[model samples]
Target chain A: MTCKEVTRLISESLDRELPFYQRLSLHAHFHLCIFCKRYARQLLFIRETLRSLSQRIEDPVFSLPPLSEEARESMKRRIREQVLPPDQGNLEQ
Target chain B: MNRKQPIDQHQTSHPEVWVDQHGDYLFRYALLRLQNAELAQDLVQDTFLAALRARHSFTGQSSERTWLVGILKHKIIDYLRRSWRECPVDEIDSSLNSIEEFFDKTGHLRDISHGWTADPGTILEQREFQGILERCLAELPFRTATAFSLREMDGLPAEEICKILGISSGNLHVLLYRARTHLRHCLEIHWFVKIRKD
Candidate 1:
Protein backbone atom coordinates (compact mmCIF):
# COMPACT_ATOMS: atom_id res chain seq x y z
CA MET A 1 0.00 0.00 0.00
CA THR A 2 1.03 3.65 -0.51
CA CYS A 3 2.36 5.77 2.33
CA LYS A 4 -0.77 7.91 2.13
CA GLU A 5 -2.86 4.78 2.63
CA VAL A 6 -0.69 3.77 5.59
CA THR A 7 -1.30 7.14 7.24
CA ARG A 8 -5.07 6.67 7.05
CA LEU A 9 -4.78 3.22 8.58
CA ILE A 10 -2.59 4.71 11.32
CA SER A 11 -5.45 6.99 12.33
CA GLU A 12 -7.85 4.12 12.22
CA SER A 13 -5.49 2.20 14.47
CA LEU A 14 -5.62 4.70 17.34
CA ASP A 15 -9.24 4.02 18.26
CA ARG A 16 -7.82 1.07 20.26
CA GLU A 17 -10.98 -0.99 20.11
CA LEU A 18 -13.42 -2.41 17.53
CA PRO A 19 -10.33 -3.92 15.91
CA PHE A 20 -9.80 -2.56 12.37
CA TYR A 21 -7.09 -4.60 10.61
CA GLN A 22 -4.74 -3.77 7.78
CA ARG A 23 -2.44 -3.22 10.79
CA LEU A 24 0.07 -5.63 9.22
CA SER A 25 0.42 -3.80 5.93
CA LEU A 26 0.36 -0.45 7.70
CA HIS A 27 3.24 -1.48 9.99
CA ALA A 28 5.17 -3.02 7.15
CA HIS A 29 4.95 0.35 5.38
CA PHE A 30 6.19 2.45 8.37
CA HIS A 31 9.25 0.19 8.59
CA LEU A 32 10.37 1.45 5.21
CA CYS A 33 9.06 5.01 5.50
CA ILE A 34 10.40 7.08 8.41
CA PHE A 35 8.40 10.13 7.31
CA CYS A 36 5.06 8.34 7.48
CA LYS A 37 6.06 6.85 10.84
CA ARG A 38 6.71 10.34 12.20
CA TYR A 39 3.39 11.45 10.73
CA ALA A 40 1.64 8.60 12.53
CA ARG A 41 3.23 9.57 15.84
CA GLN A 42 2.18 13.18 15.30
CA LEU A 43 -1.39 12.06 14.67
CA LEU A 44 -1.35 10.10 17.92
CA PHE A 45 0.01 13.17 19.74
CA ILE A 46 -2.78 15.36 18.42
CA ARG A 47 -5.38 12.77 19.47
CA GLU A 48 -3.86 12.68 22.95
CA THR A 49 -3.93 16.44 23.26
CA LEU A 50 -7.55 16.65 22.22
CA ARG A 51 -8.52 13.89 24.67
CA SER A 52 -6.72 15.71 27.49
CA LEU A 53 -8.50 18.94 26.67
CA SER A 54 -11.85 17.16 26.87
CA GLN A 55 -11.25 16.06 30.47
CA ARG A 56 -11.85 19.63 31.52
CA ILE A 57 -14.93 19.96 29.36
CA GLU A 58 -16.31 16.58 30.40
CA ASP A 59 -16.31 17.15 34.17
CA PRO A 60 -16.30 20.91 33.98
CA VAL A 61 -15.67 22.53 37.34
CA PHE A 62 -17.95 25.19 38.76
CA SER A 63 -15.00 27.57 39.04
CA LEU A 64 -15.25 28.58 35.42
CA PRO A 65 -16.85 32.04 35.15
CA PRO A 66 -20.62 31.74 35.29
CA LEU A 67 -23.49 33.99 34.49
CA SER A 68 -23.72 37.07 36.64
CA GLU A 69 -25.93 36.87 39.71
CA GLU A 70 -28.44 39.13 38.04
CA ALA A 71 -28.58 36.85 35.01
CA ARG A 72 -28.85 33.79 37.18
CA GLU A 73 -31.72 35.32 39.12
CA SER A 74 -33.36 36.40 35.88
CA MET A 75 -33.04 32.91 34.46
CA LYS A 76 -34.51 31.43 37.60
CA ARG A 77 -37.31 33.94 37.31
CA ARG A 78 -37.95 33.01 33.70
CA ILE A 79 -37.89 29.32 34.48
CA ARG A 80 -40.14 29.73 37.45
CA GLU A 81 -42.57 31.71 35.36
CA GLN A 82 -42.55 29.05 32.68
CA VAL A 83 -42.95 26.11 35.02
CA LEU A 84 -45.43 27.64 37.39
CA PRO A 85 -48.75 29.31 36.78
CA PRO A 86 -48.49 33.11 36.84
CA ASP A 87 -50.60 33.72 39.92
CA GLN A 88 -48.96 31.00 42.01
CA GLY A 89 -45.44 31.97 40.97
CA ASN A 90 -46.20 35.67 41.52
CA LEU A 91 -47.72 35.00 44.94
CA GLU A 92 -44.52 33.14 45.99
CA GLN A 93 -42.46 36.02 44.58
CA MET B 1 -22.38 25.78 51.97
CA ASN B 2 -21.00 24.19 48.85
CA ARG B 3 -20.84 20.58 49.96
CA LYS B 4 -20.17 18.28 47.05
CA GLN B 5 -23.14 16.19 46.09
CA PRO B 6 -22.58 12.46 46.14
CA ILE B 7 -22.37 10.71 42.77
CA ASP B 8 -25.70 8.92 42.71
CA GLN B 9 -27.53 9.39 39.41
CA HIS B 10 -30.94 8.40 40.84
CA GLN B 11 -33.77 10.43 39.43
CA THR B 12 -35.57 13.05 41.49
CA SER B 13 -38.86 14.83 40.89
CA HIS B 14 -37.58 18.15 42.12
CA PRO B 15 -35.97 19.31 38.89
CA GLU B 16 -37.46 22.68 39.74
CA VAL B 17 -35.15 22.88 42.74
CA TRP B 18 -32.25 21.78 40.53
CA VAL B 19 -31.36 25.27 39.31
CA ASP B 20 -29.57 26.05 42.54
CA GLN B 21 -27.95 22.61 42.56
CA HIS B 22 -27.01 21.99 38.93
CA GLY B 23 -27.49 25.22 36.96
CA ASP B 24 -23.93 26.51 36.89
CA TYR B 25 -22.51 23.05 36.43
CA LEU B 26 -24.78 22.53 33.46
CA PHE B 27 -23.93 25.97 32.08
CA ARG B 28 -20.22 25.31 32.44
CA TYR B 29 -20.59 21.95 30.74
CA ALA B 30 -22.42 23.49 27.80
CA LEU B 31 -20.03 26.45 27.63
CA LEU B 32 -16.99 24.23 27.46
CA ARG B 33 -18.57 22.16 24.70
CA LEU B 34 -20.28 24.91 22.71
CA GLN B 35 -17.99 27.90 23.55
CA ASN B 36 -20.90 30.32 23.55
CA ALA B 37 -21.89 31.86 26.88
CA GLU B 38 -25.36 32.98 25.92
CA LEU B 39 -26.15 29.72 24.20
CA ALA B 40 -24.92 27.77 27.17
CA GLN B 41 -27.05 29.80 29.56
CA ASP B 42 -30.02 29.40 27.27
CA LEU B 43 -29.43 25.66 27.14
CA VAL B 44 -29.38 25.45 30.92
CA GLN B 45 -32.68 27.28 30.98
CA ASP B 46 -34.14 25.15 28.24
CA THR B 47 -32.95 21.90 29.81
CA PHE B 48 -34.74 22.70 33.04
CA LEU B 49 -37.97 23.47 31.20
CA ALA B 50 -37.66 20.24 29.26
CA ALA B 51 -37.20 18.21 32.43
CA LEU B 52 -40.28 19.83 33.93
CA ARG B 53 -42.25 18.95 30.85
CA ALA B 54 -40.98 15.41 30.68
CA ARG B 55 -40.92 14.62 34.40
CA HIS B 56 -43.43 11.85 33.97
CA SER B 57 -41.02 9.69 32.02
CA PHE B 58 -38.03 10.21 34.28
CA THR B 59 -37.82 6.96 36.17
CA GLY B 60 -36.02 7.68 39.43
CA GLN B 61 -33.43 4.97 38.80
CA SER B 62 -30.69 7.51 38.04
CA SER B 63 -29.49 10.39 40.17
CA GLU B 64 -30.92 13.82 39.57
CA ARG B 65 -27.69 15.04 38.02
CA THR B 66 -27.57 12.07 35.68
CA TRP B 67 -31.16 12.54 34.69
CA LEU B 68 -30.66 16.25 34.04
CA VAL B 69 -27.63 15.43 31.96
CA GLY B 70 -29.69 12.98 29.97
CA ILE B 71 -32.05 15.80 29.07
CA LEU B 72 -29.12 18.07 28.40
CA LYS B 73 -27.61 15.55 26.00
CA HIS B 74 -30.84 15.52 24.05
CA LYS B 75 -30.72 19.31 23.87
CA ILE B 76 -27.17 19.15 22.59
CA ILE B 77 -28.13 16.60 19.96
CA ASP B 78 -31.05 18.71 18.82
CA TYR B 79 -28.80 21.74 18.61
CA LEU B 80 -26.28 19.79 16.54
CA ARG B 81 -28.97 18.52 14.19
CA ARG B 82 -30.43 21.97 13.66
CA SER B 83 -27.06 23.63 13.15
CA TRP B 84 -25.26 21.19 10.86
CA ARG B 85 -24.41 22.55 7.41
CA GLU B 86 -24.50 20.40 4.27
CA CYS B 87 -21.66 19.32 1.95
CA PRO B 88 -18.65 21.35 3.03
CA VAL B 89 -18.24 18.52 5.53
CA ASP B 90 -18.71 15.46 3.29
CA GLU B 91 -18.65 16.48 -0.38
CA ILE B 92 -15.29 18.27 -0.60
CA ASP B 93 -13.36 15.17 -1.73
CA SER B 94 -11.02 15.08 1.30
CA SER B 95 -9.67 11.75 0.00
CA LEU B 96 -6.84 13.65 -1.66
CA ASN B 97 -6.91 16.62 0.70
CA SER B 98 -4.71 15.07 3.42
CA ILE B 99 -2.30 13.48 0.94
CA GLU B 100 -1.86 16.67 -1.05
CA GLU B 101 -1.66 18.98 1.94
CA PHE B 102 0.65 17.05 4.26
CA PHE B 103 2.45 14.57 2.04
CA ASP B 104 3.95 15.11 -1.40
CA LYS B 105 2.42 13.45 -4.46
CA THR B 106 5.17 10.84 -4.15
CA GLY B 107 4.12 10.44 -0.48
CA HIS B 108 7.26 12.05 0.91
CA LEU B 109 7.10 14.68 3.65
CA ARG B 110 7.20 18.04 1.95
CA ASP B 111 7.10 21.61 3.36
CA ILE B 112 4.39 20.73 5.87
CA SER B 113 5.85 20.62 9.34
CA HIS B 114 5.39 17.64 11.64
CA GLY B 115 7.44 20.25 13.47
CA TRP B 116 5.36 20.83 16.58
CA THR B 117 7.80 18.88 18.68
CA ALA B 118 7.06 20.49 22.06
CA ASP B 119 6.09 18.27 24.98
CA PRO B 120 2.35 17.61 24.67
CA GLY B 121 2.08 17.57 28.47
CA THR B 122 3.76 20.94 28.91
CA ILE B 123 1.75 22.44 26.07
CA LEU B 124 -1.54 21.22 27.59
CA GLU B 125 -0.53 22.73 30.91
CA GLN B 126 -0.26 26.17 29.38
CA ARG B 127 -3.55 28.03 29.92
CA GLU B 128 -2.94 30.35 27.01
CA PHE B 129 -2.30 27.40 24.71
CA GLN B 130 -5.51 25.81 25.90
CA GLY B 131 -7.36 29.03 25.18
CA ILE B 132 -5.83 29.16 21.73
CA LEU B 133 -6.84 25.56 21.17
CA GLU B 134 -10.40 26.30 22.17
CA ARG B 135 -10.58 29.22 19.79
CA CYS B 136 -9.14 27.12 17.01
CA LEU B 137 -11.72 24.44 17.74
CA ALA B 138 -14.42 27.06 17.58
CA GLU B 139 -13.18 27.86 14.10
CA LEU B 140 -14.09 24.36 12.89
CA PRO B 141 -17.36 23.80 11.10
CA PHE B 142 -20.32 23.09 13.37
CA ARG B 143 -20.78 19.39 12.75
CA THR B 144 -17.05 18.78 12.45
CA ALA B 145 -16.40 20.34 15.83
CA THR B 146 -19.26 18.46 17.45
CA ALA B 147 -18.23 15.12 16.05
CA PHE B 148 -14.61 15.64 17.04
CA SER B 149 -15.39 16.84 20.56
CA LEU B 150 -17.89 14.08 21.23
CA ARG B 151 -15.42 11.45 20.15
CA GLU B 152 -12.05 12.75 21.35
CA MET B 153 -12.82 15.16 24.12
CA ASP B 154 -15.91 13.60 25.61
CA GLY B 155 -14.54 10.08 25.12
CA LEU B 156 -17.47 8.77 23.16
CA PRO B 157 -17.52 5.81 20.81
CA ALA B 158 -17.73 6.25 17.05
CA GLU B 159 -21.05 4.47 16.72
CA GLU B 160 -22.67 6.63 19.40
CA ILE B 161 -21.35 9.81 17.82
CA CYS B 162 -22.73 8.66 14.53
CA LYS B 163 -26.17 8.23 16.11
CA ILE B 164 -26.02 11.55 17.95
CA LEU B 165 -24.68 13.57 15.01
CA GLY B 166 -26.84 11.70 12.49
CA ILE B 167 -24.09 10.39 10.25
CA SER B 168 -22.66 7.05 9.23
CA SER B 169 -19.57 5.57 10.88
CA GLY B 170 -17.59 6.19 7.72
CA ASN B 171 -18.61 9.83 7.75
CA LEU B 172 -17.82 10.04 11.45
CA HIS B 173 -14.29 8.76 10.84
CA VAL B 174 -13.75 11.18 7.99
CA LEU B 175 -14.89 14.14 10.09
CA LEU B 176 -12.71 13.06 13.00
CA TYR B 177 -9.69 12.63 10.71
CA ARG B 178 -10.21 16.06 9.24
CA ALA B 179 -10.81 17.63 12.64
CA ARG B 180 -7.58 16.21 14.06
CA THR B 181 -5.65 17.30 10.99
CA HIS B 182 -7.10 20.81 11.19
CA LEU B 183 -6.56 21.09 14.93
CA ARG B 184 -2.95 19.95 14.67
CA HIS B 185 -2.27 22.52 11.99
CA CYS B 186 -4.05 25.26 13.91
CA LEU B 187 -2.26 24.49 17.17
CA GLU B 188 1.06 24.44 15.37
CA ILE B 189 0.41 27.82 13.81
CA HIS B 190 -0.90 29.43 17.00
CA TRP B 191 0.99 27.66 19.77
CA PHE B 192 4.19 26.08 18.48
CA VAL B 193 4.79 28.53 15.69
CA LYS B 194 4.54 31.43 18.13
CA ILE B 195 6.80 29.67 20.61
CA ARG B 196 9.40 29.01 17.94
CA LYS B 197 9.32 32.62 16.71
CA ASP B 198 9.63 33.92 20.25
Candidate 2:
Protein backbone atom coordinates (compact mmCIF):
# COMPACT_ATOMS: atom_id res chain seq x y z
CA MET A 1 0.00 0.00 0.00
CA THR A 2 1.17 3.54 -0.65
CA CYS A 3 2.09 5.72 2.33
CA LYS A 4 -0.86 8.01 1.67
CA GLU A 5 -3.37 5.14 1.78
CA VAL A 6 -1.65 3.74 4.86
CA THR A 7 -1.80 7.08 6.65
CA ARG A 8 -5.51 7.46 5.93
CA LEU A 9 -6.00 3.95 7.24
CA ILE A 10 -4.13 4.91 10.39
CA SER A 11 -6.53 7.76 11.07
CA GLU A 12 -9.51 5.55 10.32
CA SER A 13 -8.17 2.84 12.60
CA LEU A 14 -8.39 5.23 15.52
CA ASP A 15 -12.17 5.55 15.06
CA ARG A 16 -13.12 2.04 13.97
CA GLU A 17 -11.77 -1.45 13.71
CA LEU A 18 -9.85 -2.08 10.50
CA PRO A 19 -10.31 -5.22 8.44
CA PHE A 20 -7.69 -7.91 9.03
CA TYR A 21 -6.09 -7.61 5.59
CA GLN A 22 -6.00 -3.81 5.79
CA ARG A 23 -4.43 -4.04 9.23
CA LEU A 24 -1.81 -6.41 7.84
CA SER A 25 -0.93 -3.94 5.09
CA LEU A 26 -0.79 -1.03 7.54
CA HIS A 27 1.58 -2.90 9.84
CA ALA A 28 3.69 -3.95 6.85
CA HIS A 29 3.97 -0.37 5.71
CA PHE A 30 4.84 0.74 9.22
CA HIS A 31 7.56 -1.91 9.40
CA LEU A 32 9.12 -0.70 6.13
CA CYS A 33 8.54 3.05 6.53
CA ILE A 34 9.75 5.02 9.55
CA PHE A 35 7.93 8.16 8.49
CA CYS A 36 4.49 6.51 8.43
CA LYS A 37 5.33 4.97 11.80
CA ARG A 38 6.19 8.35 13.28
CA TYR A 39 3.11 9.88 11.73
CA ALA A 40 0.97 7.26 13.46
CA ARG A 41 2.61 8.11 16.77
CA GLN A 42 2.05 11.82 16.28
CA LEU A 43 -1.61 11.37 15.35
CA LEU A 44 -2.17 9.24 18.43
CA PHE A 45 -0.52 11.93 20.53
CA ILE A 46 -2.88 14.52 19.05
CA ARG A 47 -5.80 12.30 19.97
CA GLU A 48 -4.49 12.01 23.53
CA THR A 49 -4.12 15.76 23.87
CA LEU A 50 -7.64 16.19 22.55
CA ARG A 51 -9.01 13.68 25.05
CA SER A 52 -7.26 15.51 27.91
CA LEU A 53 -8.50 18.83 26.65
CA SER A 54 -12.00 17.35 26.54
CA GLN A 55 -11.77 16.54 30.23
CA ARG A 56 -10.57 20.05 31.02
CA ILE A 57 -13.31 21.51 28.89
CA GLU A 58 -15.71 20.05 31.42
CA ASP A 59 -13.54 20.87 34.41
CA PRO A 60 -13.81 24.42 35.74
CA VAL A 61 -10.07 24.42 36.49
CA PHE A 62 -9.32 25.06 32.81
CA SER A 63 -10.64 28.65 32.89
CA LEU A 64 -13.33 28.34 30.22
CA PRO A 65 -15.83 31.09 30.87
CA PRO A 66 -19.29 30.21 32.13
CA LEU A 67 -22.59 31.28 30.65
CA SER A 68 -23.27 34.97 31.07
CA GLU A 69 -25.58 36.01 33.92
CA GLU A 70 -28.07 37.39 31.45
CA ALA A 71 -28.11 34.09 29.55
CA ARG A 72 -28.62 32.31 32.86
CA GLU A 73 -31.54 34.53 33.79
CA SER A 74 -33.11 34.11 30.37
CA MET A 75 -32.81 30.34 30.59
CA LYS A 76 -34.34 30.27 34.03
CA ARG A 77 -37.16 32.52 32.95
CA ARG A 78 -37.86 30.38 29.93
CA ILE A 79 -37.87 27.23 32.02
CA ARG A 80 -40.17 28.82 34.54
CA GLU A 81 -42.55 29.87 31.84
CA GLN A 82 -42.81 26.28 30.66
CA VAL A 83 -43.32 24.77 34.14
CA LEU A 84 -45.32 27.50 35.74
CA PRO A 85 -48.95 28.49 35.34
CA PRO A 86 -49.17 31.47 32.99
CA ASP A 87 -50.59 33.79 35.62
CA GLN A 88 -47.99 32.53 38.10
CA GLY A 89 -45.07 33.08 35.68
CA ASN A 90 -46.07 36.73 35.32
CA LEU A 91 -46.43 37.10 39.12
CA GLU A 92 -42.68 36.48 39.63
CA GLN A 93 -41.98 39.48 37.43
CA MET B 1 -55.67 28.97 42.73
CA ASN B 2 -54.99 32.65 43.28
CA ARG B 3 -51.55 31.95 44.72
CA LYS B 4 -48.77 31.18 42.27
CA GLN B 5 -47.47 27.64 42.24
CA PRO B 6 -43.82 26.92 42.97
CA ILE B 7 -41.94 25.72 39.87
CA ASP B 8 -40.15 22.84 41.53
CA GLN B 9 -42.47 19.90 41.85
CA HIS B 10 -39.82 17.68 43.49
CA GLN B 11 -36.82 18.99 45.41
CA THR B 12 -34.23 16.99 43.51
CA SER B 13 -35.44 17.57 39.95
CA HIS B 14 -36.06 21.29 40.16
CA PRO B 15 -35.49 22.66 36.63
CA GLU B 16 -34.60 26.15 37.75
CA VAL B 17 -32.07 24.81 40.21
CA TRP B 18 -30.53 22.87 37.34
CA VAL B 19 -29.99 26.21 35.65
CA ASP B 20 -28.00 27.45 38.64
CA GLN B 21 -26.00 24.29 39.30
CA HIS B 22 -25.30 22.77 35.88
CA GLY B 23 -25.93 25.67 33.55
CA ASP B 24 -22.38 26.90 33.02
CA TYR B 25 -20.85 23.47 32.68
CA LEU B 26 -23.43 22.48 30.10
CA PHE B 27 -22.91 25.79 28.33
CA ARG B 28 -19.15 25.27 28.05
CA TYR B 29 -19.67 21.71 26.90
CA ALA B 30 -21.97 22.84 24.12
CA LEU B 31 -19.89 25.92 23.30
CA LEU B 32 -16.78 23.85 22.75
CA ARG B 33 -18.64 21.43 20.52
CA LEU B 34 -20.94 23.90 18.78
CA GLN B 35 -18.40 26.76 18.75
CA ASN B 36 -21.20 29.28 19.13
CA ALA B 37 -22.11 31.07 22.34
CA GLU B 38 -25.67 31.86 21.32
CA LEU B 39 -26.32 28.40 19.95
CA ALA B 40 -24.79 26.79 23.00
CA GLN B 41 -27.09 28.85 25.19
CA ASP B 42 -30.03 27.85 23.03
CA LEU B 43 -29.17 24.14 23.29
CA VAL B 44 -28.73 24.42 27.06
CA GLN B 45 -32.16 25.96 27.31
CA ASP B 46 -33.53 23.28 25.02
CA THR B 47 -31.97 20.64 27.23
CA PHE B 48 -33.61 22.09 30.32
CA LEU B 49 -36.96 22.29 28.60
CA ALA B 50 -36.61 18.70 27.37
CA ALA B 51 -35.58 17.60 30.83
CA LEU B 52 -38.55 19.37 32.36
CA ARG B 53 -40.88 17.56 30.00
CA ALA B 54 -39.15 14.25 30.52
CA ARG B 55 -38.47 14.78 34.24
CA HIS B 56 -40.94 12.06 35.10
CA SER B 57 -38.77 9.49 33.32
CA PHE B 58 -35.52 10.57 34.97
CA THR B 59 -35.35 7.81 37.60
CA GLY B 60 -32.28 9.24 39.29
CA GLN B 61 -30.07 6.43 37.99
CA SER B 62 -27.39 9.14 37.71
CA SER B 63 -26.76 12.58 39.10
CA GLU B 64 -28.98 15.40 37.87
CA ARG B 65 -26.02 16.95 36.09
CA THR B 66 -25.29 13.75 34.21
CA TRP B 67 -28.91 13.46 33.21
CA LEU B 68 -28.98 17.06 32.01
CA VAL B 69 -25.77 16.62 30.04
CA GLY B 70 -27.18 13.55 28.39
CA ILE B 71 -30.17 15.57 27.26
CA LEU B 72 -28.01 18.44 26.06
CA LYS B 73 -25.87 16.06 24.01
CA HIS B 74 -28.87 14.89 22.05
CA LYS B 75 -29.96 18.47 21.42
CA ILE B 76 -26.56 19.37 20.04
CA ILE B 77 -26.49 16.37 17.70
CA ASP B 78 -29.96 17.13 16.44
CA TYR B 79 -28.88 20.68 15.70
CA LEU B 80 -25.81 19.44 13.87
CA ARG B 81 -27.87 17.08 11.76
CA ARG B 82 -30.10 19.93 10.65
CA SER B 83 -27.29 22.34 9.90
CA TRP B 84 -25.22 19.74 8.10
CA ARG B 85 -28.11 19.00 5.77
CA GLU B 86 -28.28 22.66 4.89
CA CYS B 87 -24.52 22.91 4.16
CA PRO B 88 -23.65 23.36 0.52
CA VAL B 89 -22.04 20.36 -1.13
CA ASP B 90 -19.19 22.48 -2.50
CA GLU B 91 -18.00 23.36 0.98
CA ILE B 92 -17.42 19.72 1.81
CA ASP B 93 -15.77 19.05 -1.57
CA SER B 94 -13.44 22.03 -1.18
CA SER B 95 -12.37 20.80 2.26
CA LEU B 96 -11.43 17.48 0.66
CA ASN B 97 -9.23 19.33 -1.85
CA SER B 98 -6.98 20.59 0.94
CA ILE B 99 -6.53 17.06 2.30
CA GLU B 100 -5.01 15.99 -1.01
CA GLU B 101 -2.48 18.80 -0.82
CA PHE B 102 -0.90 16.99 2.16
CA PHE B 103 0.53 14.40 -0.23
CA ASP B 104 2.78 14.61 -3.29
CA LYS B 105 2.48 12.76 -6.65
CA THR B 106 3.95 9.53 -5.25
CA GLY B 107 1.34 9.47 -2.45
CA HIS B 108 3.95 9.99 0.29
CA LEU B 109 3.28 12.62 2.93
CA ARG B 110 4.71 16.05 2.10
CA ASP B 111 6.25 16.68 5.51
CA ILE B 112 8.09 13.50 6.42
CA SER B 113 9.94 15.28 9.23
CA HIS B 114 6.88 16.67 11.01
CA GLY B 115 8.01 16.49 14.61
CA TRP B 116 6.02 16.40 17.85
CA THR B 117 8.79 16.16 20.45
CA ALA B 118 6.92 17.10 23.60
CA ASP B 119 5.62 14.30 25.77
CA PRO B 120 1.89 14.04 26.27
CA GLY B 121 2.07 14.95 29.97
CA THR B 122 4.00 18.14 29.36
CA ILE B 123 1.82 19.14 26.44
CA LEU B 124 -1.40 18.60 28.35
CA GLU B 125 -0.28 20.66 31.34
CA GLN B 126 0.59 23.77 29.43
CA ARG B 127 -2.19 26.37 29.15
CA GLU B 128 -0.58 27.58 25.95
CA PHE B 129 -0.90 24.13 24.38
CA GLN B 130 -4.65 24.19 25.00
CA GLY B 131 -4.89 27.63 23.36
CA ILE B 132 -3.08 26.44 20.26
CA LEU B 133 -5.23 23.33 20.08
CA GLU B 134 -8.43 25.35 20.08
CA ARG B 135 -7.09 27.63 17.39
CA CYS B 136 -6.33 24.63 15.18
CA LEU B 137 -9.81 23.18 15.70
CA ALA B 138 -11.41 26.52 14.86
CA GLU B 139 -9.63 26.55 11.50
CA LEU B 140 -11.45 23.46 10.27
CA PRO B 141 -14.73 23.74 8.38
CA PHE B 142 -17.89 23.34 10.42
CA ARG B 143 -18.64 19.79 9.25
CA THR B 144 -15.12 18.55 9.87
CA ALA B 145 -14.89 20.24 13.26
CA THR B 146 -18.25 18.87 14.37
CA ALA B 147 -17.33 15.39 13.17
CA PHE B 148 -14.00 15.51 15.00
CA SER B 149 -15.54 16.87 18.20
CA LEU B 150 -18.21 14.21 18.22
CA ARG B 151 -15.75 11.42 17.59
CA GLU B 152 -12.61 12.40 19.54
CA MET B 153 -13.73 14.88 22.16
CA ASP B 154 -17.23 13.57 22.83
CA GLY B 155 -16.22 9.91 22.25
CA LEU B 156 -19.24 9.04 20.17
CA PRO B 157 -19.10 5.88 18.13
CA ALA B 158 -18.69 5.97 14.35
CA GLU B 159 -22.21 4.70 13.69
CA GLU B 160 -23.82 7.28 15.92
CA ILE B 161 -21.82 10.09 14.32
CA CYS B 162 -22.80 8.90 10.88
CA LYS B 163 -26.43 8.95 11.92
CA ILE B 164 -26.10 12.39 13.48
CA LEU B 165 -24.29 13.91 10.52
CA GLY B 166 -26.60 12.12 8.06
CA ILE B 167 -23.72 10.58 6.17
CA SER B 168 -22.67 7.03 5.42
CA SER B 169 -19.88 5.41 7.41
CA GLY B 170 -17.48 5.87 4.49
CA ASN B 171 -18.12 9.62 4.39
CA LEU B 172 -17.69 9.79 8.16
CA HIS B 173 -14.30 8.11 7.89
CA VAL B 174 -13.09 10.58 5.28
CA LEU B 175 -14.34 13.52 7.35
CA LEU B 176 -12.49 12.25 10.43
CA TYR B 177 -9.35 11.62 8.36
CA ARG B 178 -9.45 15.21 7.17
CA ALA B 179 -9.95 16.47 10.69
CA ARG B 180 -6.99 14.55 12.10
CA THR B 181 -4.75 15.47 9.18
CA HIS B 182 -5.57 19.16 9.26
CA LEU B 183 -5.35 19.43 13.04
CA ARG B 184 -1.99 17.63 13.17
CA HIS B 185 -0.55 19.74 10.36
CA CYS B 186 -1.74 22.98 11.96
CA LEU B 187 -0.42 22.14 15.43
CA GLU B 188 2.89 20.95 14.01
CA ILE B 189 3.53 24.30 12.40
CA HIS B 190 2.09 26.54 15.10
CA TRP B 191 2.87 24.70 18.36
CA PHE B 192 5.56 22.05 17.81
CA VAL B 193 7.76 24.17 15.55
CA LYS B 194 7.59 27.13 17.91
CA ILE B 195 8.45 24.93 20.89
CA ARG B 196 11.42 23.36 19.12
CA LYS B 197 12.77 26.80 18.23
CA ASP B 198 12.51 27.92 21.85
TM-score of each: 0.74, 0.88
Candidate that scores best on TM-score: 2
Interface RMSD of candidate number 1: 6.7
Clashing pairs in 2: none
Please give the TM-score of chain B in predicted model 2: 0.87
Question: In lDDT terms, which candidate is top?
Answer: 2
Task: Evaluate model 2 with DockQ and give the value.
Answer: 0.53
Please state the Cα-based DockQ of model 1 relative to the true two-chain complex. Answer: 0.35
lDDT of 1 by residue, B1-198 (tens): 124332222445444468778887787778777878888888888888888767657777787788888788778767866776443655334332443586667765453555567676557777787788777887776666777778776778777877776778777776777776676667766776678777
The CAPRI classification for model 1 reads as: acceptable
C-alpha DockQ of every model: 0.35, 0.53
Encode model 2's per-residue lDDT on A2-82: one tens digit a residue: 788888999999988999999998988988999899889988898887777777765544656799999999989998888
Write model 2 residue lDDT over B70-182, tens digit each, in one string. Answer: 89988988888888889886786564447778899999888665556777755766788877877888888888888889998888999988877778889988889998888
